[model samples]
Target: MLQLLRKIAFPFSLIYLLIITVRNYFYDIGVFKSKTPNTPTICIGNLSVGGTGKTPMIEYVIRLLETRKLAMLSRGYKRKSVGFQLGNEESTVLDLGDEPYQIQQKFPTKSIAVDANRLNGIAQLEQLIKPAVILLDDAFQHRKVNPHLSILLTSYACLYPRDWYLPTGNLRDSKREARRAQLIIVTKCPTNLSEEDKVAITRQIKPKIHQKVLFTSLDYAEKFKDDLGQTVDDILFQDKQIAVVTGIASPEPFIQHLAALNLNFEHLEFSDHHHFTATELKRINGFDVVITTEKDFVRLNGKVDSLYYLEVAHKFSEKDKSVLKETLESVF
Candidate 1:
């Protein structure tokens, strides 16, 4: 039935494509002006609507550029506060959004801010920190502020070339727009992806001479931790029946990780960045051992006692890692 509905929505996807094409045309032809800040800026985003491993990639970049004083800007999707707001110790998930709030929590000293207008947000962050380099999270579609470096992410399971427009497919923008990115990353790949698979995927993407393509897999943390900085005992999960709770774009990769570990769990999935109600919290509390993603853990913290989150990081070959670092360093 869902497949039939998507087939019916195929015409709407064409309409969406036309509208997006026209918008890109205006930007390309200089009918729409894009702002370029004096400070070096890097954009990490995807062509699809969600589940591209963008947050983990952003964290990877942050770790790589640890020496530089950094600031991050995001649109703060579904946030309660409006306009340009800077993150601080007092900032909550409602103020900075879940992803940005999670970044702030991870890097307390760094500057994190959110605004729907990329231009305004960059300006505000500049005035506040004058950061060495500004990282723009999920800003591929935001053409107003042109970034010095744009890194595009596509999931290994659903590459952009095989995707269509929104409402019917995962893509929110045209696949052709991928040409704008200087670097393209295939995220959430299997650890044992063969060279033949790489060649085939690369042939499908057909990246330009100026673009570099890379593949990476998710590296799950060895153990779970709580808000109190206490680690959970791995022995407890041994032959244990756990509840897997997630409020993110895609939970398949996380589920697969747990399954590989031979763990027993029932999934309770929700929409991306879902705000839990009091009743829902009570129900979640009933679970014996609840596991979730790091992003979801921030919101669910202090709400459920048995709750634990799995941490994930990006893993790539040393050569590709070097290429990413060198490319960013060259820009600055």
Candidate 2:
């Protein structure tokens, strides 16, 4: 039924394509100007709407630039606050959005800000803290502030070339815009992806000569941890009935990980950045144990009892790591 509706929406997708193409053309011809920020900025974004593993890739970049004074800027999707807001110790999910709030919590000392206007956000970040480098979260389409380095991400399962515009498929921008990126990372890949598969994906993408392609997979932690830093053994989970709760763009890989561990649990999935109401909270509270993604844990930590979140990080092969180091170094 969903596939049928998507097929029916093909005409709408064409309209979207025309609109985006015109917008890019304007930017290309200098009718729409792109300003470069004073601070060196890196953009990690995807062509698809969701499920592209962007946040994890941003975290990976953060680790790479840990030696420098860093700040992150985001649009704060679904956040209640408006205008430019800088994250502080008192910031919550409502102030900075889930992804930024999660990042703030992980790197407590780093500066995080959110604004609809990328230029304003970058200016405010520079004026206040003067970070050595700024990481722009999900700003590939925001051509207003031209980033020094742009890293494009595509899911191993759903590459941009195979996708169409919104309503019909997940792509929010044209696949041709991918050429603007200096590095293209294939996220959510199989850990054991063979060289043949890598060559095939590169051939399909047909990247420009200046662009480099890298592959990365998710590494889920064996144990689950709660807000208080209490952890439960992975094997002990078999003794109780568990519920897998997630409010993320893609939960399939997380679910598959649990299933591969031979665990039995019912899944309670929600939309990306979904807010839980009283009724939804009641339904979630019925489970003996609730395991959720680290992103969702920020919202449900105090709201739900017996709640635990599984940690996930980007995993790159040694070869890819070296290539990533070289590519990032070249940016500076």
Candidate 3:
């Protein structure tokens, strides 16, 4: 039924493509104005609706620029609060959204703010914290604020070139808009991807001369941590009645990682950023061990007593690592 519906939606996808093409053209030709921030800004986003691993890439860049005073601005997708809400000691997931709240928990010292308006978010962050650089989360298609540098993310398994517009496929923006990015990273690749495969993928992407493409693999942590600050290794999962829970856009990679560890568990997957109901929580509580991703853990922590989260980060090859660093340096 879903496949049939998607096939029927192809004409609607064409309509979406036309609408976005005109919108982008207006922005490009200055019929619509875009504001440039006074502070150096870099945007990390994907053309697709979700599942490009933007959060992990943002965290990776945050770690790379540890010496700088950083502020991150997000649209705060699906959060309860409205207007510009800045992360503080009292900020909750309801106020800043799951991804921003997770980032705030991980890096409490850095400034994190969310507003549907990217320009207003940047201005509030500047007025409040005066950060050296601002990282715009999931704002590649947001043409209202022209970023100084933009990094576009595309998954190795599902490249944007092969995707169609929304309701039929995952792409939310036109593929031609990818040219705006200064750097493009292929996320969620296998660690053992060969050089020939790299060349093939880059050739397939056909990035412009100014744009550099890099590959990254998801590096899961060896140990898992729970809400009480307790850590456990994968060996311990062999004896436990495990339930692997995930509320993320891409859970297959995470599930495969556990399978690679040779662990036994029941998989309980949900839509990305799903808010669990009381009945669902009770169902999940039946398992002896509930494991999830860090982003999901932020929303599930106090609700699920047996919850534990595994951390994942971006891992690049030595050569790609140097290229990424040099590209970021050039951004400033």
Candidate 4:
């Protein structure tokens, strides 16, 4: 029935595409204005709605810029508080959203700022800390502030180059958005991905003559305990049947990472940024342990004990590290 409805609505979807296409045309033809920043800007974003691994990739860049003066910026999606603010000190899931807070917590020294206005946010951040490179999180569609280098992220399962516009499918905008990015990466790849698969996917994008393509996989960090505080493999993940939980854009990678650990568990998937209630907790009465992603843990304001979260850290290889650093340095 759902499939039938979608097929019936296909003509309406085409109308949406036509509307989007006209809007994009104006911007492309320069009838509409585009904004750019004074400082060096590198945006880590996806063309589609979600699940392109932007957070993990942002974290990767943060670690790389440890030695340099860097300030991380974002629109702070779903943040209760408006206007620009420091992403580290004033940040909370309530104020700055989960993604910015997590970034602040992980990279203590790196300057962080969050605001809806990308232009104003960058200006405020530049006034405070003169950074070498500013990473704008989830700014793929934000064409106003033209980034020095735009990184287009595509999930291993969902490639945006072949995807259609939204209300019809998962894309927030047109696939032409890929043309704006200087770099493209196929993220959340399996550890044992073949060279053939990589070549085939890269062919779809056609390389744009000078654009660089890369592949990245998730690297799970050590086991963490309740509320993402204690690091403990002894209690939560060891010697018990577990119920894994997560409210994220993409839960497949999280599930896959857990499966690789060879742990005995039952999976419980939730909507992105789901707020759990006491009744929902009570429903999973039989599970011995409750594990969730750190992103999901941020939304849980309700009281619950014995629930642990495995904090995964994204680690890029030495070669990948050098490639990123060298490429970024050239632009900055």
Candidate 5:
């Protein structure tokens, strides 16, 4: 039924997309105009609205450019306040988006800033960090900024050009918008995916010659222990059932990760950045223990009772890094 609605609405969505096309034409013709930085800028974004592994890809880019001072810039959607805020200390998921806060928490020394206006946010960041390179999170659609390198991310599950628009599909913009990018990444690839899979996906995507297409899979952090040195027994989790709560763009990866551990769970899904209440806590009381992703942990900072966040890290294979390095070196 949902698929049927998506197919039906696609025509309207495509017609609505003409608005974006006309706006882009204005920007291109200098009627709207765009800004370019003298400093290096790399964007990691998807053609779809949600969960093409942008956070993991951003982390992938940051680690690859190890020597350079990297700052992850974002619009900080659904954050409490508007405008530029440095994301190192004194920033919360309530203040910045979950992903930006997550990056700042993991990489404290690296600068992180957020604002809806890409140009304004970049300007504000220049005053403080003077980053060697700026990594724009979900900036593929931000036509106002001319990135040094544009990376278009698509999910292994769904490619945007082939998908329907919002309320029907995950894409915030049209698939043709992807041509503007310098590189394309098919993210959230399954582990042990063969060359046959890559070839099939590449053909399905039908990228341009100018685009450097690559693939990556998410690597999760397993065997989490508490603040204490004691290792949390995996046996206990297998012996007892657990409750998995997540309010994220995609919970599929986390669910699969737990399944790898042979752990049984009852999942509680919430909207992204959902603020929990006392009633929610009473419901959580029925579970043995609660496990969630690190992205959701920030909102749960003061609310922990039996909750434990299963943290994840973005790691690419050595060969994939080599491919990424070779591509970026040509640009930066």
Candidate 6:
């Protein structure tokens, strides 16, 4: 049924594709100008719509560039406040979007700000503090500010080459736009990705001569944690029944991670960036141990006592990490 609906929407998807293609053409031909910031700026984005492991990839970049003073800028998707809002001591999930707020909480000393306009956000961030490097989260399609280095992410399961435009498929922009990125990372791969798999994907993506492709997988933490910093034993979860609550674009990997542990759980899935209501909170409170993604944890932290979040990070070979580091250093 869903496939049929998507097939019916194919014409509209073509229309969307044409609109995006023309817009990108204007930028390419210099009809639309992209501002180049004085400070080094890096963009972590995806060719598809969402769920390409962007948050963890951004965190990976942050960890890699820990020696330099950095600031993160985002569009603050679904945030309540308007205009350029710099993250401060009082910044909450409502002030910055969930992902930005989560990153701010994790890296308290680093500056984080959000504005729909990337140019304005960068200007404001520079006026406040001159960060050595600025990281732009999910700003691939926002061509107003030209980034010195752009890292494009695509999921192993749903590569952009196999996707279509929005309302019919997952892609928000044309697949050809991926050529703009210098580094293309295939994220959320299985732990044991074979060489044959790499060759196949590389052929499908057909990256430009200057583009480099790297593969990475998600490494879940050994244990879960609660609001009060209490750790939950992984052994205790063996054969135990728990509830999995997630409000992210893709939760299959997370669900499969928990299932691999031989734990039984009922998944209570919600739309991406879903804001929990009072009634939903009451229902979630009934669960004994509710496991959620780190992004969702920010919104559900104080809502339930039994709620715990599973931490995830990017897992890549040291050689690949070195390649990424070298590429960024070249821009600096």
Best model per lDDT? 3
- Per-residue lDDT tens digits for candidate 6, residues 267-294, read 9999999999999988888877788999
Put down candidate 3 lDDT per residue, 192-241, tens digits, no spaces.
Answer: 99999999999989999989999999999999998985888877677889
lDDT of 5 by residue, 1-332 (tens): 97898878877777767777787778778999788876688887876777777776777777777788777899887788788888756767878877788788878888888899999888878877888888899888898899898888887778775776665677777777778887788778887889898888888878888877788877876565443324465666665658888888878988888877888888889887677788886787678777777777767655655667765655556776687888776656
Over all chains combined, what TM-score does candidate 6 have? 0.97
- RMSD score of candidate 4 (Å): 2.5
TM of each candidate vs. truth? 0.97, 0.98, 0.98, 0.90, 0.91, 0.97
Off by over 4 Å in 2: none
**What global local distance difference test value does model 5 have?**
0.78
Q: lDDT at 161 for candidate 3? A: 87
Candidate 1 — which residues are off by over 4 angstroms? 238-241
Candidate no. 4 TM-score: 0.90
Clash number for candidate 1: 0
What TM-score would candidate 3 get against the native?
0.98
Give per-residue CA lDDT, model 1, range 189-256, as digits (tens): 99999989999999999999999999999999988876676788666776756888999998999999
Whole-model lDDT values for every prediction: 0.91, 0.90, 0.92, 0.77, 0.78, 0.91
Q: What's the number of clashes in each of the models?
A: 0, 0, 0, 1, 1, 0
lDDT of 6: 0.91
lDDT string for model 2 (1-332, tens) is 99999999999999999999999999999999999987989998988888888777778888888887999999999999999999999898999999999999888888989999999999998999999989999999999889999999999989998888988999999999999999999989999999999999999999999999999999998788987978887776777888899999889999999898888899999999999998999889998888899999988989998898888999999888888877776656
User: Ten consecutive residues with minimal summed lDDT in candidate 3?
Assistant: 323-332
- How many clashes would you count in candidate 3? 0
